[model samples]
Target: MMTTQGGLQPTSNEANMCTNDNGSQLGTRIVDEIMAGKNVFFDLPDKLTGEIWTLKFHCIGAQPGKEIVTVNIDKAYVAFYNVVYIKSKLGYSGRDFLFYKKRCGIDRSRLLALDYIHQEEAMLSDNMDERKISFVLTKDPPSDLEVSITPIKRPRQRTNVDEETIEVSIDAYKEWLAILQHDNPETDLMDDFREDTIKTYKEWLRHQGDLPDILLYERMKNKPEDVDIVEWHYMVLYFGSEKFQKISSRNSENRQKQRTKHIMGYRTFSQISFQQRDPETGIEPTDLSLWMITHCKNDEWSEEASRGIYENAAEKIAEKIYQTEKFYLTREEENAIFQTTFKETTGCKANRLHGHGYLSRYPTRSQVMESKFLEQARATVATNQKNIELESQVQLLNEKLACEVAERERILQEKMQALQEEEEKKDKCLEKK
Candidate 1:
């Protein structure tokens, strides 16, 4: 169906109706390529699907508790699919999707707080079924719109595959490229991302001083300026840091210029990224860029607001998979995702509170544990000391009582002896008289 800015773009789905033979082809592509972990994302052509919806996938690895891969639609597209596609089709049941914003969790709060979604168009269809939580998207819609995955091909062709390069998660690679692009706006695509991002990542690796043989092989080229997209993607994700951008190998005035550019790029990424400015007008980082940038913001005000988007990303990636993927997570695993997000979001804020409060005195994680342990130990020692002092005082009181008793007994004996003498004197005097 066609969708407009304020209303659904109603489009006819007559051209791409699936024939009996080709009905499962589109579904098979989704299962084989996206869910199978061969590709992170691909653009779905409207021609193949008869324009039912514009589709893209951000595939995430099956999380620890999850057993199968999950497919997530971009948040912007959720509404149209909910209201126009599913709701409009009378043949389908109301028990289909869980309204993303309505989902329960810390992330739900975060997504609700986004400035982008408050717009009129962002509102989800109110008529959706509240009861059905888990449903699968079929390869063939009743509209007969066939679906297919556009396979992701690397920009550069490598005849010989280098097994040394570390295999990275697709979501992580996308994140790496996004951060790289935000830092360097001069390049629009990850395949084209170069200069500062690659250099900083390489310098970061050199600073670590234990560059893996695979990463080292790329940097050890005959020239100092060679760039590999895959190699740089891996290095930046695992090891890249602003602090380590100036390693020993990069110790010169020219190197300083590169660092200056890198710093400027980071500063630019943090400031204007939230604006969501178009690349033509200013800059647009990747979809994931917003979440990554928001997490990195330091200022308290911007930080909280940015964290909303950050948690939103986590929810979208992990929880959104439940709605669209074939291999469903158990109810327990679903709850686990919610709890994990709640902790990541709330736990970070708790850390900040500790930093600002007196608890800042306890810095590191182990140090915090040690400090708490020490406090408990000190409390135990103090209680033991108080017990010892009380026992000593009780012993001293007993000794004093014993001494007083002895003194009293001695006085009584002496008095009795004196009385006896007096009595004897009186008797002698009487006898004498």
Candidate 2:
């Protein structure tokens, strides 16, 4: 039977004698603590000629335990049965390594051991060790170590070419509204404003930030996380050109009752952590941080999880007007919003949402597999049906063949009988003569 921890064990007395002979300072306890904790790095050899030793202690059969109290200096790793292992097991103190080390009588702390569980905090104090490592401890050790490694780069297949997708969740969407409110407390897309007539949209739009945030924010507010930012922007701008603003008298009171409930929309720059840009092609894969705009999903304007996609083109339109002419609301606002890049040709070649490519549905592996299985099943049924049809045709042909053969034999028998009758008549006539 192979042993654990590189497979060689030494008795506690033998281990102590060997350590004495080698003049090694740090004992088994210190090394075990380091191994178990979240230290960034540690070295085996100090001024003390210290080498780590590990073994399975007090195990029943093949099971390993936390009871390795004795360590051998000569053997780097210990075998299970080879060395009569120690009966005494050490349990962790709820405290970290530094605290535990302080409680210990040994002043060989630089050469000492501590609890491995306190690694994240311990690494701060144990900075002298040259070799650095990231300590990852779990409630249960994972079956595969590769589970922790994330690919530094994603494959090219998931590119977001049209520049529409911005990663924002529903919370992020609400935050954008909060931001718009932050920029101008009076300007709101869904929020019941104090008389935000189209007449006042120009005034509202001018106070806002530039094109990128406005367009990106509008699409993000919709439940669908993936959106074509450009298309949404153009759609928003198009609607802004039209004048009548939505006015709900009851909604105003309800809005007041809601009471600017979630006003914290502006996220700090540091909070924008989860984004990636491909080094080779400079293409950004779509980040669906926003809730997805589902095909046939029900979403509320004020609900937390998946909110409704209100037509906020009016919001986009006013912003476009602000970008073009800061304070003026004009009929030209309609014509001007489309003129930006997407509409180079004369007559609005693209329909509503010209620049966007909202996927009808997001494809998943399971969905694709289901479709393929269904297709194969249908093909199998068709083949079985065709075989049954051919079998029936063959049976009919066999019956027709048998009937033809029987009819031919019957005709031959009749002809033979007639011949016999003729011969008999001739014989009778001759006898008369």
Candidate 3:
């Protein structure tokens, strides 16, 4: 049987070895096996056990069929056993070399000896010697030493872009309002305009600071409408004009009460509900509702949003009163109140729906001036009422004087006629005697 130099048992199927004098026979048999392809060729010198040598066996049959192979050893332990072998037998009987290595202290690390074969062989031929090999072989040996090797890699790094999207909920919306109020207190918080208004507020809170305190403050605060207009200018930049239109359309009574109470603490804006006929069919109770003026387009002041189209109807009636010299507000007061600018063609258009309430509903420039003129005319008539009364008294006195004069003249004439008649009668009596 063939034997290794370390003095272990002979490998099974190997012929028994002779003494040192018969070493030639061992060399001849090993050479013949290499030439015949029955044994794999090893680079180690023949009889490699003389100086504590090791032989690396590589499976080198080009395409040989599977067979039971036994490794023999005499002077040294089998440092490793390749697991590829179906079964391994010892010098006399079939036994696995792996089991043999485990019983011996050679594989205590549970490391298969194949782990060192390639590296050890490379060292003997190259720069690695007894010193370097000891250092390398004793440490956790690299995987490359195995008969088969695998590529190793590091894990990829994670990033923010890889995160999943999050959705906004109603509860989350309410909580956000609370946060905005806590942080900003100078603004009027009106939940009257829900969508665009809330969106604008959120954008503002986000840009308030670097590594913005939006989440932190939103978590702590309870009011959003309390945020000031100027402070939220940055946030407002992100909102488009379309969002405003949507908010104007969608903010209804039900939503307004809930959203506004949380945001502004009070309802500061108007809410009007209304409905109209479908126009496809005629029906008496077609629709009914109040008009919401806020939703009216600034340019299109039509029935669509302008509930009060005749806003200056009262002003027109007041103008009629002015033309008749009626004095509601006097000339001096009117002049002092409204100073018309004569320089511009369109100084103050009376048609301008400028002021909020009903009093000075001047819808056009000429109408406003007319109002002032009427006030002046009324005041003049009021101041000259005493002259009118004095003229009436003088006319009455002149009529009574003319009537007395006529009665005196009639009485004088009658007296004169009677005297003449008496004189004539006396003359006639004298003549007859």
What C-alpha lDDT do the candidate models reach, one value each?
0.41, 0.38, 0.36
Candidates sorted by TM-score, best first: 2, 1, 3
RMSD of each: 28.4, 23.3, 38.6
Model 3 lDDT, full chain set = 0.36
Residues 1-433 of candidate 2 have per-residue lDDT tens digits of 1123522234465445434432122235434433443122233332333533332222222113321223443232221111212211121112212111111111222122323333434533342232221222122323433222222343468676877877745355446556676887765465346454432443334443344456546654663435444466566555444331233455566566541122214542113212332343332222221122221134433343222122233345557657774665542344334333223322334344322232123346897687557656766777788899899999988999989999989998999999999999999999999
Of 1 and 3, the candidate ahead on lDDT is: 1
Cα lDDT tens digits for candidate 3, 1-433:
2334422234533523312213334434444444343322133233435333323222222123211222333222222222111112112212222211111122221224433344434434331121111111222234433232222234677668868868756455456666767788664653558776776566545544422345434433443576643344434432324576477557654364321111112322221111232232211110011112322344444342132322332343356457765556543333222222111212444543221222334337787687556656665665466577777777777777777787878788778888888889999999998
Q: Between prediction 2 and prediction 3, which has the larger lDDT?
A: 2
Taking all chains together, each candidate's TM-score versus the true structure is: 0.20, 0.22, 0.15
> Native-vs-model 2 lDDT?
0.38
Stretches > 4 Å off in candidate 1:
1-351, 354-372
Per-residue error (Å), model 3, residue 285? 56
Model 1, backbone clash pairs (residues 3+ apart or across chains), number:
5
Any runs in candidate 2 off by more than 4 Å, and if so which? 1-136, 139-199, 207-215, 221-413, 429-433
Judged by whole-model lDDT over C-alpha atoms, candidate 1 comes out at 0.41
The C-alpha stretches of model 3 lying farther than 4 A from their native spots are 1-379, 383-387
